[model samples]
Target: MKVFNEIETAKLLPMRELMEALRVAAQDCVEGKIVSPERMVVALKEGGIMLSMPATADDIAIHKLVNVNPRNSKEGLPTIHGQVVAMDALSGVMLFQVDGPTVTGRRTAAVSMLGISRLLAHQPKSVLIIGVGKQALNHVEAIAEIFPDAAIHMRGRSAHGAQMFVDQMKSVAPNLRVEEAGVDHDVVIAVTTARSPVYSELAKPGRLVIGVGAFTPEMCEIAPAIVDASTVYVDDPLGATHEAGDLIQANIDWSRVKSLASAFSEQPDFSRPIVFKTVGTGAWDLAACRVIKARL
Candidate 1:
């Protein structure tokens, strides 16, 4: 199998390309054209978790094995690492391998971008990203590439942490600033793993809020009042019911939550606030592989 390195994997899955692929995959998932089951997660001794995600579609099949080790941060190492393997669905032949963390980070960011493209009534002029982790960096890069003109702002627990994140992202989002502007950001994305709420401000019209982190029910990024004030949409309808920490903690009605496919098929009431929660699925990974495989 042809093995692609981290940089190579990134080159294969460009922001706009992967975002479009995710769009198609989202529709396919809704139509039952793709088969992606709930991921199998195993806990490790060090409070880490090993995740196995598999998906099969008419065009491609993929499996992602990723280990998330939060304790690695103390050793100055990446928190997540793994690889994604692609295969011919019919022949069952391994075709190629790509870096798992790359696919996860980029695809997760692309999901947010897709949400922005489909949910927002207009282009986001200003965006506030909460958290200084890898997900935040991926989002900054994705937004810069897809919406080059949009002003990017980042927020962290501390000012130093936020500035350091901006310094690291200078190459991608040079003008990225610490979010202290008086004007309201058009989009607010919370990518933190905070158990308590990180963004509690009430959701308002003309603003889109996206929750990227907080997978388990014990974790949350947005406050309950925000989820209550906004029309909630999740990237994976099935996954959200179980993994969407913010929504689950808020005790929102599942039937009221809409899917991303509905965002494309049905028109939303833009006059009201909107919240997009994403607890990723393997279908997105399968779509990401298709983007890279097509180039090969």
Candidate 2:
């Protein structure tokens, strides 16, 4: 069986193509052409979590195992690490194993961009990303790819870390701008693990808010008021209700919730602010697997 490490996987999964693949998968999931079991998570010490997500569609089967260690950054290690395994559904034969973190970082950012592409009426002129984690950096990369002309801004909890992040980003894109976290940006992406709201005044009208962190009920990154005010969309309805703290805490009307799949069919009203929250999904993992395999 073939094995691709983290670097190889990251190299294989290009952002634009991966985002499109996820868009296709999202449509398939809504059409009932795919089957993905709910992810299973186990609590670990020091506020960490380990999860297993498995899914099957057509002739392909895939599983992703991930670990989240909140304290890893203190030890100079990445907070997330994992692996993705692919198999032939009919023959039950193992096909390959790829680095989980690479697939996840790329796909998760792609998922958020997918939301932006489908829901937003226009390309953003300015973008604000709150948080400097792996996801945040990847989100910047994806945003840069999708909206090449947009000015990029970043904010993190620690001022020093935020500066460091900005410096690193400048090394890559010298013209990128760094700004304080605020409410007026055309696109706002919150990727922090803050238990409380990151920016309380994020209820600005017509802006696109992508909440990528705060997956559990105990963690709330986006303010409740923003969630309640916006026309909300999620990657998965059931997963959002159970796992998205921003949605659960806001007590959003589930009947009004729209899936990304529907965006593929028709565009929703973009006059009001749109909030897209995802708790991640196995179907996305499967979609990413297809991208990696095809590239190989």
Q: List RMSD in Å for every model shown.
A: 1.0, 1.5
The parts of candidate 1 lying over 4 Å away from their true place are: none
Q: Rate the local accuracy (lDDT) of all candidates.
A: 0.92, 0.85
Assess candidate 1 and give its TM-score to the true structure: 0.98
Best prediction by TM-score: 1
Count clashing residue pairs per candidate: 0, 0
Query: For candidate 2, lDDT tens digit of each residue in 251-282?
Result: 88899998888888877888888899988999
Question: Which TM-score value belongs to model 2?
Answer: 0.96
lDDT of 1 by residue, 1-296 (tens): 99999999999998888988999999999889999999888998687889999999987899999998878888999989999999999998999999999999999999999999989999999999999999998999999988888988889999999999998888878768888858689899998888899998878998999999888788899999999999999999888888899999999999899999899989988999999999999999999999999888
Compared with the true structure, the alpha-carbon lDDT of candidate 2 equals 0.85
- Lowest-scoring 10 consecutive residues by lDDT in candidate 2? 174-183
